[model samples]
Target: MSGPSLYNHFRTKDEILEAVADSVSALVDLSMFEDARDWRTALHEWAVSYRAALRDHPNIVPVLARGPGRRPAALRLADAVYGAMVEAGWPPAQATSVGALMRYFIMGSALGSFAGGFVDDASAYDPADYPHLGQAHLLAEQQEKIDERAFEAGLTALLDGLALQYEQARATT
Candidate 1:
């Protein structure tokens, strides 16, 4: 599938990139947004699903990182998140922020992650030089768990903050 054969399906780089983004976006579990009772729960589920999908197709993460553009699947994802948030009582602006914020978290995770950035050398972190990073050398070996935990922590913090903001807005309204 090299050269002309591949080019037959995608004549231009933009077309190829758009196709990749669409295909990857289709893997995400947008259905999570449909039946959940709370926006927080729905967004949490969707984010987890989105991250899982991205993990499997990490090479496409950069393409997905670009805003929805004109891709149908990508736009649907954007619409679903923003719509779900607004329907759940988020202000329009806040809903947009939720979409952007979630994208950054999920796509950033799919892109080369902090935990995975460490070299897997036991002596990389010298005791005297990196007193605080005694266990840092193990990070590469534990990249999966570390990345998952980091995602969970980030998602939790984001949702908690949004929940508080939503509550305050509701109280005032």
Candidate 2:
């Protein structure tokens, strides 16, 4: 179905997006992030789930890339991330940074993958002329593996940074 037809079926973009987001979010293991009493465990699991969900649904790329407010799914995910950070004992300031990092990591990686929307068909570059592009394409071919590492590295760094911030907050209080 076309965009217009889809939109007509739904009252507004927000409603459609919310339904889409709700469907996707339901598939995720939210308990992994919420149930973990330890902050590290929750953060790590949340990161892993976010990246995995993004990777699995390449079609949601346009929704996510459009902007947080434009897509209910993105907004829902953002809220969850921020909520998780708060539950982990992060300060309000740190919540924004931490959620932003997770969003950036997942969406940026999704965009990097050729699987996502908006293919650059106009830009043609020879692998011989641009080795980096060529190598990137090869890596994109193995997106699942790359996604795992990206999630792990990004999650570890985010958690470590948040941990430091929490310590600072503790020190002051």
Per-residue lDDT of candidate 2, residues 45-130 (tens digit): 76667656766776665666555664544566667777877777777787888777766766776655433222333244466776
How many residue-pair clashes does candidate 1 contain? 0
Candidate 1 TM-score over all chains jointly: 0.93
Candidate 1 ranges beyond 4 A from true positions: none
Q: lDDT for model 2, on a 0 to 1 scale?
A: 0.65
Scored by TM-score, the top model is 1
| Candidate 1 local Cα displacement, residue 35, angstroms | 1.9
* Residue 57's lDDT in candidate 2: 76
Steric collisions counted per model: 0, 0
Worst 10 residues of 2 by lDDT: 114-123
Expressed as tens digits, the lDDT of each residue in 1-173 for candidate 1 is 77667788888988988898898888888886787568989999999999998999888888888788899998999999999999988889988988998899888888877887888786988989988988877788888998899989999998999889999978887
- RMSD for each of the candidates: 1.4, 5.1
Give residue 24's lDDT in candidate 2 (0 to 100).
Answer: 62
The TM-scores, one per candidate, come to 0.93, 0.65
Q: Give the TM-score of candidate 2.
A: 0.65
